[model samples]
Target: MQLPAKGTPPPARDASGLATLLRTAGATDTVLAATGGWLLSERRSSPATQDGYIRDVSWWLWWIQARGMDLTDVSFIEADTYAAAMRHAGLAPGTRRRRLSACSSWYAYLQRADAAVRNPFHRMDLPKRASKPSRYLTEAQLDDLVMHAVAHQSARTAAIVAVLKATACRISELTGVQLAALGHAGDHWILTLTAKGGRPHRVVIDDDVTGPLLDAYLAERGSAPGPLFATRTGARLQRSYVQELLQRLASSAGIPDPHTLTPHAIRHSVATALLRAGEPLDVVQALLGHADPRTTQAYLHVDQLERSPAHRAGRRLAAVVARRLHSRTGTREPRPADIAQAT
Candidate 1:
């Protein structure tokens, strides 16, 4: 098939049209054509996801054409070489990984359909990303944020912040929450969130602050079965709108770098608070609804622990050990003053 120009846009969202376009462009492999169609037609995939997959796959096709190879001719070595080329071309590590993942998904689909003999990406190793410290607000900063939202912004904004910090839920989860999903257990309220992969998990709003704030927001929203957080027009709040609201609140609160104060940052603050309070990793994993414990472990921060009781205890123990050694040896560890005096 004749490949499109190097910078051409990806195929449109119509699955059948996309398949026809691939076939007309000289993609003679039946499996390759079918995989492209399947990707476009997958019910779980959003339009944005479809566009991303198409772009990534289009880049792969262009690469194969440039190298005088066919889609079905890609071997493990070719796949590895493509990754190496991406790296040498100065693509970011995350971008390279995403592109490789898109290719791997296509191959996996082909394998499921018995269109390919083997998956070339089966043995491909992804680059390890350096873990950065999770950005979060101090407890005082968080309190200031909430106070600003409550006083300056609307009740909806305050409730949004409260729910995010209390539940440590993703923004998507918060926006998707339905009023019907919220339930009261005696004195406290519980939120049933459909997290990533449509997995439903329940979290309790046991704190007095969150529960009262949520109650005020709900009272303003009225007894409705729609989204827990909706606009004046009764439409569910969009993710971007929520992000902008948080930024505005952060600015009003006098927080530095207001742009960095996001829903995820609030979630990070909650996770760090829990971990520093001696919450078990497994408990945090369950609360965050992480399928893997390692994912939850990433939210744990050592720096946040500096002000905790356990950290103070550790410092006290070290001091005690030093004093014991001094008494036993009849020689204290020399201070900078003692060294200077001796010199």
Candidate 2:
């Protein structure tokens, strides 16, 4: 439970130590492949990624089985119904799209063996993921949002907000934080996570912001070895739950289009905050655990949207129009308020 210092690389995780995310025990031999065993066994992806792929494919299979349907004969209507069902269940648009993709890959494998197997999801429409998430926050604004959660929400909500903003970790990484992975050393708090490829990644958070919020939540959550953020039954919090939590809080706080304040948006906020503070692009990429700096480079555009020089120049031009309008009306020169309103 005690780490030497913050930002220290965590011990590497053993591949065999990872639990199979999807159980194939209940599946009949004929349908075993449908549970995503081949995908997991093939090692085409990192263990963390395969975990996700299996979890998603398993859920799709489970839903179909519950409905007493077989994948071989599933129609587009049934696939469409499943997509609708995921939406109704509050799955984020991106999460739903990935889940569908994972399932489609499984079905694709099935087709290799027999060309007659139809992929209902092959033609399904999914929401496009934005090149970069639209939302970003300065450190101060992020703290204010955390304060809002503290005042208007639960300790757990505040902690969730703090973790996302401070670390910029992926949702999967956050869910992997166990009781043993949390520690404090010197002035910073250390959080160890199972990163992509099952590597143990560490994020160092300042005590000034995230430390107290996380501590408060854990005090209430108890000393269980399960996920740091868990359901009442002590299972890891699903990605959908975290997304819905942020959306709900944003709605209550009267943020315009609450759905835009997504969990991934919080990740964007961290990358933006770091870059604007004059952190090097490589440093930002390293902190965010991005394999490619180009991914981190995308965060730089967020400021243009927030403080567009073109927008400001256009506002100045619009103020000239206010003067024209006032001259036409034979009224006194436009006041500062009038110019502001025109802009």
Candidate 3:
């Protein structure tokens, strides 16, 4: 697909028009590859993940075609329909979310590059998520995986997973960690992250496995304060390499294949673990650097298995009072205590 150029007139107000905008924005093969390379140099993305984003955009382009709808002219109804169709196609909830997110981001890029006037995704309703986090590594599973990753011949590969899982960092955030971003906290070290949306936060390097691995790795690599991690060739690591490495680690650890295990699962696993430990919603929200707590709420469900004694007591008392009134009188009336309780 062709992205539009600067000051180019908006495309034909259809899918092709959207494609033109994308082309203009340099989301195309040659341009996107170059753009990804540039973003890598600037540390916007690891070279590997830029490739993933490129792949994601490629699939989105294909998916757009399969649906036979013009993204440039996508209406609210059409967008909604696309979401529904994606669900009906048996796509995993996470996959659907990513595809939608990809489209949403591309559209925004189009707008910024002046390829399009506005992003249709800005104000449209879409499908509700599955109401729960789908995949999370159990504590035991996480431990085993970390152990295996750390023991792997490649210390750098192991550290990648340890850091991503322990810190709940996006792969991008993990890759962006540099020596300059680290600071001492009285008695401990901290990893600073500047995430997407330009928000900055700190990930405490608690007694987590990745922290020590990172320290050792740093020392072996000369312990500089520049890039903390990099490829064996001394170039910064890529996102695709991380994904592939994660999958290899999972396979070796005898972990169940949830289709594709990724660094992203680290984010979900950490958030789920925090919520399960009864961490406050706000705390989890901040740890994940979410702009809203509601987003984190989707990862937690109030434990229904444990019945509250107070709630059961209230129900039992109401039943008893209802039976007593029927035995004492021909009709039932609101008891004063019940009224006060309701109030």
Candidate 4:
């Protein structure tokens, strides 16, 4: 892609090939360079989020090409139609909203550079998102999944799953753990982590996990401040690797829809386990690194099986209280015989 020179007329619009439009949109020698720079400078979003925006804009370019519409001639109606099409394709509302925002940002950049006029997407309404509770695994199911992961995966992968479940950490946070984060007090090892948004948290390593983590680190001679999980080639492990590992393990364990087994699910399992153990909400919220208690509360649902005992106990207590109240109120037979004897 080649950027047009300053004050030059925009290249004649084309209907196919987004790479061409992206190139022509560049006003300098590097057509895509400016856009990339602007995206990287955004402080509000993470690197991953910025990358998604770039991908979304790239897709919008492809959509323009597939529909035989000139990118320069895109209008508000066209943007609305595209959004509708995305919804028709079964895209989630949140996803559609994000994609629209990405497109809007791209167009806004073009307007700033005088490469384009108005962003058609500025006035477009986004889809409304419905609230859905997070899904977490039961303790038995969590045990089964973790045990299967341990048996089928390498020590590193198994430890990754274990830490994710026990620590309630995001995948990025867990994979980004540093070796120096580990501190020991006698037989106990505590792993400290810098969580998302620069929050620090500490997770106590249970006896069961300590052996696996130490063994995995030792096997690799991991004594420095480097990535704990690495690929076969000794490079930092990528997110896709963890996902594939879960899929393979789930399939082997006869778990339906292996794709459903994700790192986030492991985090959810941690909250579920804590709630089942009758841990207080504040402690769970802190352990999960939730800035808002409400976010953590979403993961605090109790299973019917877990609540049955409490429900039964309440019923029993109510019956006993009712009997006591009846006796105290003289509802119990004040023997008619006692009344007759008194007369």
In terms of TM-score, the best-performing candidate is 1
Q: Runs in model 1 with CA error above 4 Å?
A: 1-72, 76-91, 184-188, 222-226, 231-236, 304-343
> What clash count does candidate 1 reach?
2
Report every candidate's CA lDDT.
0.75, 0.71, 0.65, 0.68
* TM-score for each model: 0.69, 0.63, 0.56, 0.64
Error of 1 at 99 (Å): 2.8
Residue-by-residue lDDT tens digits, candidate 3, 1-343: 2222323332223333434545644354543433333334433343344444544455445545556655455565655666676667666776667657755766666655555445666765545666553566766788888888777747776677677777788877777667688787787788888776445788777665667887777767775446667765566677777878877888888999934787787688788778888888898888888887888886664343235577888777777777666766655765857534433
Ordered list by lDDT, greatest first: 1, 2, 4, 3
Top-scoring candidate (lDDT)? 1
**Over 4 Å off, model 3:** 1-133, 207-209, 224-226, 302-343
lDDT of 1 by residue, 187-265 (tens): 7678998866556788999567888998888888899679889888778888788888888888878998998777888
By TM-score, the better pick of 1 and 2 is: 1
Model 2, stretches more than 4 Å misplaced?
1-48, 55-133, 137-140, 184-187, 306-309, 325-343
Candidate 2's TM-score reads: 0.63
RMSD of each: 7.2, 10.6, 12.1, 11.6
**Candidate 1 at 198: error in angstroms?**
2.2
